[model samples]
Target: VNQLGIGNYLNFKDRLRHKNGKLKYVEGSAHRLDAQNIQVMFNDVTSRVVAEQQIAEERNFVFHSLDVMPGIFYVINHEGRFLRWNRQTEEISGYTAEELRHITSAEMIAPELRAKHKEFVASILSGARWEGEAELCCKDGRRIPYYYVVRHFKWQGEDCVVGMGVDLTERNQAERLALTYLKEMQSLSARILESQEEERRRIARELHDELGQGLTATLLSLKNAEEQMGESPMVAQVKHASSIITILTQQVRALSLNLRPSVLDDLGLVAAFRWYIRERVESAGLRVVLSVDKDLPRLPALQETACFRVLQSAFTNILRHAQAQEAQVSLRQADGNLVLVIHDNGRGFDVKAARQTALAGKSLGLLGMEERVRLVGGVLEITSAPGQGSEVRVVLPMG
Candidate 1:
């Protein structure tokens, strides 16, 4: 009687779908059955239905996201084996999931970092999320840079750690190339400046010993001739000519000295700078102090010249830019390198402005300083700010 009415009014499949879809299970009909049997049946059916639905959802998420996402997806089991990975991993690594599953995670890490990789994996399984940039090897026998992101998770009823990685090979290579280009530019600039200083010194020498003395002798001869022609109608004109000649000679000698200081090549860098500094201090009406390591023996001629040129540029800048009344120059030896420092208590200029000038056509002074330092493998640094004094430092390896 119950079967006939229910068959016409209700379907068993429909009833089962409604109950199972909503609650993942259905209760057995109450009759005079054993309590243990009913409870056992209920527990088994509910567990299976809930697990099946969860698995379906996870499969849907993985299948839909695998090819669509930009990065590779992966899962590792508690035994440190590759349980599953998305199709995209094959596309990126050139190894199908079937082949990857046979290999250990250690095979993916670069040899240099293999120990570190193992350590990291151990830590992650112990409840740490290990992530950093790592290198990846491609199927084409190429090593590429990649960004690795790994986390702790559960897989197949066991705790595991999984990771996703993105290719950063191109971006990292471009950055490295840019840095290499910058270093090359700086090196070339230094060389150019060093050559320019050598040319300047050569020109200064030609002017001093060759041109200046010749002009001085000519003016002295004119003076004696004019003195003998006194009281003549041309006497006033002769006196004027003599006066002009004397001035011209003086100007030529001064110009020659300014072009290249003879003291620099004659004495070493220290003595040369001391003389130059003294002259500058007197001319600027400012006090100047000099401190040098007395025990520091004479360095290589070329090295000393470079140091002198650095000092020369610093004082030239000081005279032009620094507005302070006192300046200090110190040369010391420390850590097997010669350190030259020039500090001036004068009006300072913007450091960025100076660097920009170095970048521009007018950056000759800074470039020249850098060039001289570079010839002997030295480094020059300038520090200054508005209203603060400027400091110039050069460090040259003694070798």
Candidate 2:
């Protein structure tokens, strides 16, 4: 009223005690009618004021909920102005609340990803939900990978984007650890295979050089004894012993060759492969067609061993499980890599299930072949289905 007397009008809102002893809000106005008279009016506004207070309380609750969430949350306008953000946004970005408000969303993205961020925003604005991964650049220049999901909506009558981002640091670390462990396991397996080959070679040499020669000398002695004691039962017994000794010598020679074929060490991979196909595959009653590149050069010892072992394993599978009548083998050099493929017409098994079984340790032949190829930094692929034939393909780098 005092201000209205000096001026023309006055307006205000104030709380008052109601007749029933309750607090009420009022919006009041006063107008000076003349030098000595004034008009005053008061309008009840308790409902409007109470509703506004409730809305403010709810807004605060929502903000608190966002802050307690596990990941980064943020809201930005079409111009990329930060309208709201949670505690994680500031924490991960290494920026204070005030600093974030002054920067745009693109400013937080790594420079190389800023352009992509713009496209993501545009997509959201065009009414499509966006989800992808990007690197966030912190204030300290640290780049962190984050997977984000964003949507467009209206905030207080203004177009805005709301987004959530999850950190991928732990996931990436776990994957790296798994890869490292796998490599170590493969290296150990390669060493074991090398040791086994060495042992086999030693055993084969002993059987061929010692036991084989001993058996041959004994047979010669028995033959000479029979010649000296003619027309006697003792001569007949010595002759019989000579025949038995000759048979034993033949068996020993076969075992030695099967353990480690001397041809492999002396004549190289081609000779070894041809010998195996003729002596092993055909002897097992499986007709085989072999094609080789005439210009294929000799490979490193380990590589040649890996290739030969894989071939043996594949053919073993064909004979034991494929139930096929015929098989085909091919070896060639292309792009500085050795390519070997084997196919069989035998009844095939499910490749995926077989692989799973092999991985689970229920089967070792397939797994062993795969490990041999991997040890040499090569790739092995097996394809097959029930009622169809099976194929094993291997590619090894020559260098």
Candidate 3:
């Protein structure tokens, strides 16, 4: 046997022949065998070489990909020292390759998160994949949040853990902005609701004290004149005027109550709803079944108002849109929350379409109800479909 090249094996046999009284040596092997045999071995060797070259190229591409990837990539040894890191990792940590070599991977973790970092290392050492969010302490002493994933891997015959991290700065900032915007919106909605209530109360007072009382006085005057005038045509006209005044007074009272119910401000939510269902809903030919918990604790003014108004709007919508004959309203405290559900068996409409319409400003009443619920940090859900019953659920956090 003789070595031909790297990874290439060739078989050779030496034969001796007597040529002039001396032994002559000649080399003969698989390569020097029949032409067909040599061709077959050459082809097999060439195929293997080509395959190996392809594998090498693939590995090179993978390394290049890792280096140029937009995320941070790093390798840490069992001792938690960084063995290697990609360019992004270096840029994000504000450390060079040489500087990283002197520091352990744990050094890059924030001090408060060192315990969690240790746990991750232990888990990786035990062959478990770990993934979580952590703050990375950069070389400039600034901490940045990162979402990271690490797994145990064997690199160059050494047990190491490889990790990848994506920066969460932009995502976290966007989330914070969204939360702030939501809070602002809620505050604006609350203000608008407060203004609306104040206006309603003012109008109700004016109607009761001015319009209502004036109508009563006029009716009394007409009654006196009718009694003094004797049984004549003028007396009949006075009686007719008195009757019209009575109807007008009653109408003014009903309108005032609808605008700002005195019971809602005097009693709590339950009493108000009971009166509303009896006087408004049932009077409008819609049978209402109301269930309320006993001794319901008084909620904050905002929450109570929000809940009442939401129901009022719901009833209005039911009457205006839902052609259902009966409706159900329930209120109770469950799991630290005040839960209200209103269901109507009416010709329902598409809930999604209604919401889109409300967003488009066409359904101002529905939108107002939603805003009221959200102002109190509550959620409103409406379940309805064409030709199906509609259910509105409101959940308000009590604590």
Clashes of each: 2, 1, 0
TM-score of 2: 0.81
Ranking by lDDT: 2, 3, 1
Best by TM-score: 2
Model 2 clash count equals 1
Collision pairs in model 2: 324-346
* Candidate 1 residue 313 C-alpha distance from true site, Å: 3.4
Q: Write the per-residue lDDT of candidate 2 for residues 264-312, one digit (tens) a residue.
A: 8888888999999999999999999999999688899899989999998
Candidate order, TM-score descending: 2, 3, 1
lDDT agreement with native, every candidate: 0.75, 0.90, 0.85
lDDT tens digits by residue: candidate 1, 263-330: 77777777777777777555777678889898777788779878987887888778776878888889
lDDT winner among the candidates?
Answer: 2
Q: What's the lDDT for residue 371 in model 2?
A: 88
Off by over 4 Å in 2: 1-62, 114-120, 127-130
lDDT of 3 at 239: 81
